[model samples]
Target: PALRSIVNPDDARFLNPPDMPKAIQAFCRETRQPAPRTEGELVRCAYESLALKYREVLGWLEELTGNCIEVIHIVGGGSQSAILNQFTADACQRPVVAGPVEATAMGNLLVQVRASGELATLAEMREVIRKSSKVAVFKPGPAAAWEDAATRFAGLRRGN
Candidate 1:
């Protein structure tokens, strides 16, 4: 079934949109997939798709930067999920360091501090965050099958 919650069912952004999780549920219903009522399923779909997109985008970034960047820092509420974090590490085939869950809040506060002449650049802000926040590191699991999932997800997108 076609996904129902958006003007374009092809756009995966409708799934677990940042603003409203309800809209995401509706998006699932549109596709005849089970509405992910539990936090785990909801986050699972969002994180899995996000990891795929991150890998895809990272490839584009690599092309643009002409460098193979292999580390990612995931900070925020979404980063709290060990399952999702490991999944991202696996999907991207890179080590991911996650934590400082209050990133958004910290960023906002940092901006305020900088604007008040208490800081200089984003680097300084990040230094402060490094001091203030706890971090957790994640390494890609032994799931070589994640590579297959990435291919399967791509196939799903292409309808092959």
Candidate 2:
């Protein structure tokens, strides 16, 4: 919010075309906005920007596949960040299912189990994961703000 007040929220962009810190500084310089000086601002900017990128990629997927993705299931360590999960839900206007922070380890164990012929198929592994894991669901909130943010991100990506 403080950062928004300092610059046109409409000018916000995802800062990943370059590496993180450099991209953020470059973007701030290009937009004539002050660079984020505090850890909170930097973290907020990165999280929000990532959420916008996720929305963009999801849109591309829907366009290319002719399928509507209703929910985003985020497994792995990244799913542990509730802030990111909420931001993703807001940005994508979709419910986000986040859990199994140890997804990689779980999958490795499952693969071994499957190789041993205890698990029959991928579906069986998924069922076991579902039964054993606890997941949190984040529902999309009011989307007007995120819609505006997305527009800004899109414009930035296009070098507008």
Candidate 3:
């Protein structure tokens, strides 16, 4: 994940932070927990938390779609997180594909290309993605523990 409020997009933040590892460290300090100083630990915390939130969102998506999700595609700067992608696969119990870190621009370009008749169909767009960009595919792993972590995480949030 990256910084938000960059003039075009604005979004909001804590422990198990979705972004800002520094903020996560601060939260840990406030709670008398050891701060995550290493990159791996900080990233892990963020991934785990983000995975839980994504699972929650998927629950709503299922309600809207009225079916089980088949696959997930994560595109953007945040998609660069292998840890996050793996966690998403595990927690969401679905395959997660991440790629084209600059997907915003690429997707915009594709829309323009399609408008110009250079491409057609969403399937064709994805084929372009496969041939033209590097993607990381993550399969779901054991997620039983994530539920407990998520519950504790929710408690931390409720205290706020």
Candidate of highest TM-score: 2
- The residue ranges of model 3 lying beyond 4 angstroms of the native Cα positions read 1-26, 29-39
**Clashing pairs in model 2, backbone N/Cα/C closer than 3 A:** none
Question: What would the TM-scores of all predictions be?
Answer: 0.68, 0.84, 0.71
Residue 82 accuracy (lDDT) in model 1: 82
The TM-score measured for candidate 3 stands at 0.71
What does candidate 3's lDDT look like per residue over 38-115, in tens digits?
786766665666777787689889999999888999999988888779888887889998988989998899999999
* lDDT of predicted model 1: 0.71
* Local distance difference test scores for all models: 0.71, 0.80, 0.71
Worst 10 residues of 1 by lDDT: 1-10
Write down the TM-score for model 2.
0.84
lDDT of 1 by residue, 3-106 (tens): 11112224656655765467667655755556767666666666676677777778889999999987888889978988778877887888999988988888
RMSD of every candidate to native, in Å, equals: 6.1, 4.2, 6.7
Best by lDDT: 2
Error of 3 at 13 (Å): 6.1
Candidate 1 regions with alpha-carbon error over 4 angstroms: 1-47
Q: Arrange candidates, best TM-score first.
A: 2, 3, 1
